[model samples]
Target: MTRRLMLSYVALALLVLLGLEIPLGYLYARGEESRFAQSIERDASMLAEIAEESIEKGNLTALPELAREYAEDNPGARVVIVDRTGRLLTDSAGTIPTGSTLAGEPDIAAALRNRTTVATSTGTNSADVLAATMPGSSGTTIRGALRVTYPMTTVTDRENRIWAVLALAGACIVTAVALVAFALARWITRPLRTLERATAQLAAGRLDNPPDADSGPPELRRLAAAFTHTATRLQHLLQAQHGFASEASHQLKTPLTSLRLRLENFEPYLDPRAHPSLEETIGEVERLSRMVHGLLALARLENTATTPGPVDADAVLVERATMWEPLAAEQHVTIAITGPAAGRVRAIPGALEQIIDNLLANALRVSPPGTTITLARAPGAGLHVIDQGPGMPEADRERAFDRFWRASDSHHDGTGLGLPIVRHLVHASGGQITLHAAPGGGLDAHVQLRPAGRERRFQTIAVTHAAAGHRR
Candidate 1:
């Protein structure tokens, strides 16, 4: 992130430099060219006036000397004087033949025609030259042209010097800007890094204390304060949950112990005449044991760390089905398994098993004789338990999973916590359970489990139980 920010700053600086330098460079070059052109024109105009005055005085002998002196003063300038008939009269360089006709030169020809002209050439001497001409005198038939050639080397040299200074300044400015940008980036990102570390600690459940809020910028300080508040709230919530679980488990222990003791004391007094009463008492003790086990399982689930590995859904279902098979048989019910037998998923193993047990128990109690309680596993993922009992109406389906929610007319001897336990376990395992009406008949409860490891695909297991409430 710091690197990105630095690069962004550099890009912006470059854009600003280009925006300033391009137009300035162009205007500087153009202004230099314009100044040079104007100087050459002024010199030509002065020379033309001097020639006219010299001719009017009829002193042709001093003209060549005057042109030579002008050329020496200007250093790199070439000057020439020509007649109206396109014949060169005086030349500063002295090499050109005096009688040569200047008609072949485009600028010279335009000047001889009594028109001002300027032209640039690049053959023997690569320089821009300006030539202009006007009538030597107004009344007399005297005509002449003045021409001057100036090299662009001096102009180019000046521009190069200016550009070199600009480059040096730009370099220094860029260096300073880069240093400032890096400092600013660090100032911003340092606090963000600290916040990241704090969040990681929180996720790992190692946040025993809050983060220090005085480390960086103002915005980061505020963020750290917010994180501290959130961590405090989470710590309090976890403590409350643990306290509640502890209190509930302690409260339930006495009734469970009493139920066990009563069953034990009544066992030896059983006779053939009271065998039915003995069996009922034994069933009640078993039910109490199940309730205690469920409560303990729920407490452990709430307190324990989340499991990191994938769970085998089919294996869990098959194992729980086998464990409860005898109980279902004793109750005159037939348990059947359906759907894929082997599917993997992510969940806490014991919690998932308990959830399955609770659902099965609920189905067993409410189902009528000869009706099938189906545990059907969906092929792809999740578990579905369908019982063909008097199917719960749609309105009651929502309330079925609430804690201690027994139907008003329910005849089953239960603590009314079966579905609630199932719901808690499912949630702890990162899954969900929904109770709905079965398509054909009875209550259909669906358990969706979290997706497992990459290589292991999820599959749903369906189990069906046949009701035998009317069996002798």
Candidate 2:
């Protein structure tokens, strides 16, 4: 951003310099050439007047002397005088014969007709020359043509110098603009960079380095102050939530457990017909207890923030399957491990084990005796807990992640938070979880986790340790 801003400033400066300096330099050059042409024209006209008397009387003796004196006064100038009959009378450089025919030259040709002319042409001594030709006339009768030629370098050198100076000045201004623009860009973006870091930290559930409200522009300052307030309020709310979860963990579960135990204790003393009602009441109490615990667990999970790191998905799958094997055997159900290995997957510390445990437990609950519960590693960084039980409808699968949403045909005592908690953990690990029909007609809990390619600074042993609600 800083670089882009600086370049923008420099580009704008260059545009302004080109717009101003180009025309200024061009006009100065044109004005210099105009002034140069006027000086030559004035010199030629004055010489024409000087030569008028000598040429009119046809006295050539003093004309050569006059031309030589004029040439000596102005360096790199050639003077040529042509008579009325198109013959050179005298040459200032003495190179051409005095009677040489010099009438064909454009400036001389125009001047012979009593018209004055000034233009640039090729020179014997240089590549370019500016010549001014005027008729040496007496009483409107043309006597001779007087032409004065100066090297074009006389005017071009000044034009070149002016352009060079303008270019240097423009370059200096552009350089200065770039430096100032760089400084200004940095100054403006420094506060934005601070805000960016603060926003990222806030999104990750902590704001370690809060932005300074008074350090930047007024608009940014106000935004910083608002962000700080929002972060403070969020921290306070999370703290209150954590406190509530901790308190409710003990308060809510104790009464529910006591109620279930008290109701069960009355089973021996109650009438036979009352036993059914008592059982149902106890079951409701147990379900309520599970619901309270599930909600508290969710609250606690949401209160803490964690970054996902590499975990050996295959190892966790095998370990979980082994752990749940005894429960499956007790129900005469077979637990089968299949499929290829799911390599290192991204998961929060100890989250993979909890996810696998929850999915397998749910699978085993619906699975019938003599049926196989398959624990498989799907393609890529994925896992599947396939069971031989009745699969849910497509609509129910979509709402399965909602808290306390139970399937209509669910028969077992469940709090209906198993799928929700599983989804929460999966999503926190940057993964997706879905329920599909198994091959033989059961629910296949398909979980797709991100692949952890590089090593990170985390305790990889956490993946093998116990997970939340692992024992329960």
Candidate 3:
């Protein structure tokens, strides 16, 4: 943005300078040429008056001496006298023979025809020359032409100096404009850059810390204020929504408990054949109760602000395997934990546990009898929950992490919120979860976590071994 702004300013300045300087330079050159030509014309006219007397008397002897004297006074000028019949009478430089035909010269031709004339020449002298020719007549009868040739070095030098000055001035102005534009661009875009960074932070879910609105230009200040206002309102609205969910879920448990107690109280009076329906009703009630807890947990997960730290993911896998071992045995399923217990990743405390618990629950639900469920460590601080069950097809796996999504063939006992809750927790803790086909015909639920910096705990085993050796 700053570069564009600065270039725009410089382009405008260049355009203006070009418009002014181009015509000014042309005029300067033309004016210099005109002034030099006019001076030579004036001197030629004066010399023509003197030559008229000498030509009228047909005494051209003194003319050469006069030309020599004129050439002595003006060093770079050539003087020539030519008659009306196109014959040169006397040459100032003494190179051209007297009586040489010279009528082809434009200035001499025009002067012979009774008109004063000026011509610029690039002749044999290796320098441009300005020549002025005037008729020398004895009472309107043309006698000869007085031609004065002056080298254009002085005029050209003056023009060059003028052009140099113009160029220097133009350059200076353009440089000044460039400096001012750069400074102005910096001033203007600095605030805008800050606003851009603040906007990015806001988009990245840093809503609790609003952008600073007190600095920058007035327009940007207003924009920042509006951003802060919108963020604060959104923050409040989300808080209210989550607060309602949390409160509603908490409030629902009491009535649910009371109803369960009442159902238990009525169970004894019911017939034994009716016991199945009663049990089903109790199961539904318990499902509802579990759903309420799930809702509360989901709400809490949404609101949970995770501060990342190192966590032993392998240890988490082992711990979850140990905890769910009894349940797996009852289902005739084996839960196996594999990989190093020292592997670590960055996540919130209990986040890995939450993810493992949800995944283990889902795996246990879908696995068949005598199948093995492997919780293996994947590369790059990741975990894989591999289950040899009726694994999801490609279509169902894509949306498995979506809220309340369940595979079409799966049992209907679950609330279908486990993977979604896990996904939220993993994302909140800067981790990723994906479902892929396992190597041996099962679902591989992959969870890759952000690697944590190695802490002092990583060195503890080495340090302990060293201390033991020293004691021995």
Q: Top TM-score: which candidate number?
A: 2
Model 1, CA-based lDDT = 0.69
Residue-level lDDT for 423 in candidate 2 = 81
lDDT of the candidates, in the order given? 0.69, 0.79, 0.77
Top candidate on lDDT is: 2
- In candidate 3 the C-alpha lDDT for residue 46 amounts to 91
**Candidate 2 lDDT, tens digit per residue, 349-465?**
988888877777776676667887766554544456666676666777677777777767666787888778888888899877766655656665667677787634221211111
- Residue pairs clashing in model 3 are none
Task: Sort the candidates on lDDT, descending order.
Answer: 2, 3, 1
**Which stretches of model 3 miss by more than 4 angstroms?**
1-7, 36-222, 251-270, 307-357, 369-402, 405-410, 429-472
The parts of candidate 1 lying over 4 Å away from their true place are: 1-179, 203-206, 222-226, 259-296, 330-335, 338-342, 373-438, 441-450, 455-472
Q: Which ten residues in a row have the lowest lDDT in candidate 1?
A: 463-472
- What shift in Å separates residue 113 of candidate 3 from its native position after superposition? 5.8
Give me the displacement of residue 135 in model 1, in angstroms: 9.6
Estimated TM-score per prediction?
A: 0.62, 0.81, 0.67
Stretches > 4 Å off in candidate 2? 1-8, 51-54, 57-80, 88-102, 120-129, 149-154, 329-340, 367-394, 408-412, 431-448, 454-472
